[model samples]
Target: MRKFFLAVSLVLTSFSVFAVNSSHCPHSCPSGTPSSNFVVFRAPYTLSNNATTKFADWVAYRIAPDTIQGGRSRNFRADPLLFSSRTLEPDDYTGAHAQIGTDRGHQAPLASLGAFSDFQALNYLSNITPQASGLNQGPWNILESRVRGLVQGGGFNEVFVQTGPLYEFFFAELPGANERHTVPSGYWKVIYTNVNGNIQTAAFIMEQTTPRSSNFCFHQVTIDEVEARAGLNLFPNLSGASTVERRTGFLRNDLGC
Candidate 1:
């Protein structure tokens, strides 16, 4: 009987490991919802109708779902099983080609993740976007730099960032390898700052394109909008942000999407 009980215990332990390792476990925070197969981590705060003001609020991707990579080349769809969102449309801002003069910019610049050894992971199309070459490589990069500086200065432990496409007036669809094609009008970014051991979050959203807009004229948005659209909170204190944020961002940026 003792031997049988031990055997059963081992089986149960193995099963638990399997469940966590299976890649099907929900990794998101608004708990009880089905997990996204590819979700690496879920944020803790619930999605609010208003944009978030904190800089440290953000969500992290798990693993990419197989469905997105198959030869079909259909519209990339995030599996509902893994995430809970009012909208599941492909991240339109990422990887979409811009007009003849525009460049696809990355809010989370690829260079930011240079420290990671698995550099290929940072090349995934999911992390890219279309922006004016000057802007993307300029002010956008500046923002990233500023944030990193803050982290290094010890002003905060971790910063949460939520970014997305900004669509203003519609434009004509461009032909591409995939069926649907349209350039996002602009982009939105929200940041949550963890300062003085208090979880203070700040958000910044911007619309970068307008006929009269100068390269430096990107408009910042409010926190409420970000939370409503992103459907997730900014930070949960599992690991210390000061050490983990830079490390994880560098890993994800250098490795892939």
Candidate 2:
């Protein structure tokens, strides 16, 4: 078991390094941060409405930040138009106007963030994704909800998320744009926690826009894989955990998540 785990870990680690080094960014912005695993492009010039017509209460922004394995963090600023003296509805949005066929998908869901301050920061357009309706509301939403639930349930307080689509074909086209941008066929999310003398991290990868299927049918990969792809380690201290059992056991016993 020990030998098998070590071999698997080495393979994953190698792949991460290779993927990061090999990936290229053709259309990334000049000021944006680019990596093989992901790219942080500049936000749209204007704010748009939420994708779901169910709500129209929030505004958006664009930001760029460093990407770490299991998550990404950016210096986000909220739109003044969306703020209210009272709690704003998460589903509420102004309407999809500026960008045609581009749905204003929330990087941080309204349900997950209730505090006015938190919502204010998360509603920025930089964090939003121009995703398909099915992909935005389906598995992507589910995964966001799950992560929020975990945080609320004391899984972790300081959690960062960086997510985007993985276009399957090199020349695949976006749903509603004249120029083609990379359409993600899969999505990646990393979660990390430090609570009560415990430290834990998790990574999830799911199909981007599969219809009628569970939105977050994810496959777990090693922390090394995540770190390599994201180019930053989540648990820098746990470098010795070479096996899944060792890594997960440590999480269960320490973080209790």
Candidate 3:
């Protein structure tokens, strides 16, 4: 049950977007799978592997009321789910420490997963990209925290989140040997939510750079745009899920700006 979409009926609006059962889903492209270039891992949350990129192609999860808070210190480690040695290990990011100005930017943010076990799952190298200090701590961090606040105050029936990085190219002449890995030029996150009967989806993109202030790197995008950029279907099963995509952000309420 934790691995795939819920088997029970998820009546979003009229017809079910997700299949009645994960076994017989109508979607041509589900979150993750074995046949594709990415391998799927469902440790309660969904993480799809992209061994060629040495990171996750996407990480998806459904957030509920209980996801707002979880008390635990970060325990960074390698992903045990990945089978191929070609995938990155924790050691690959040793040079990406905060002291070096690059961060092991989490694609599936730990704050959103709050629970200790779920949070720990995010520490996998597959869930991270080499992000600059500014973007990691600035707009991106603020956006993650604000989402928690929104879910806490409001009553959202279901929230599906998919996050991953966007690769442009690789540069061997970067700062360190670790930098030789495929560094993403930007990152994207898409959030699907059902509130009271109406559904809304928010998408965002940010460059991999350090920001001096919050919201500086926030580029509001649409689900279609992200689909084109990420080269993957976020919710292929959704069919014509909804056109209520936003360009600005996933932030339901403003944190500061």
Best by lDDT: 3
Cα displacement (Å) at residue 5, model 2? 47
Judge candidate 3 against the unseen true structure and give its global Cα lDDT, from 0 to 1: 0.59
**Which of the numbered candidates is closest to the native, going by highest TM-score?**
3
lDDT per residue, candidate 3, 71-181, as tens digits?
Answer: 555677766655435366666666555445677777767777666355676676667677777788888887766655556765564466777877765422224445235
Expressed as tens digits, the lDDT of each residue in 176-220 for candidate 2 is 433223333454554555457354556555554445355353355
Candidates, ranked, lDDT: 3, 2, 1
In candidate 1 the C-alpha lDDT for residue 54 amounts to 9
Clashes of 3: 3
lDDT of 1: 0.36
Candidate 1 local Cα displacement, residue 63, angstroms: 19
Clashes of each: 40, 20, 3
Q: What is the lDDT for 234 in model 1?
A: 30
Q: Kindly provide the TM-score of model 1 when superposed on the true structure, using C-alpha atoms.
A: 0.49
Each prediction's RMSD over C-alphas, in Å, is: 13.2, 15.2, 7.0
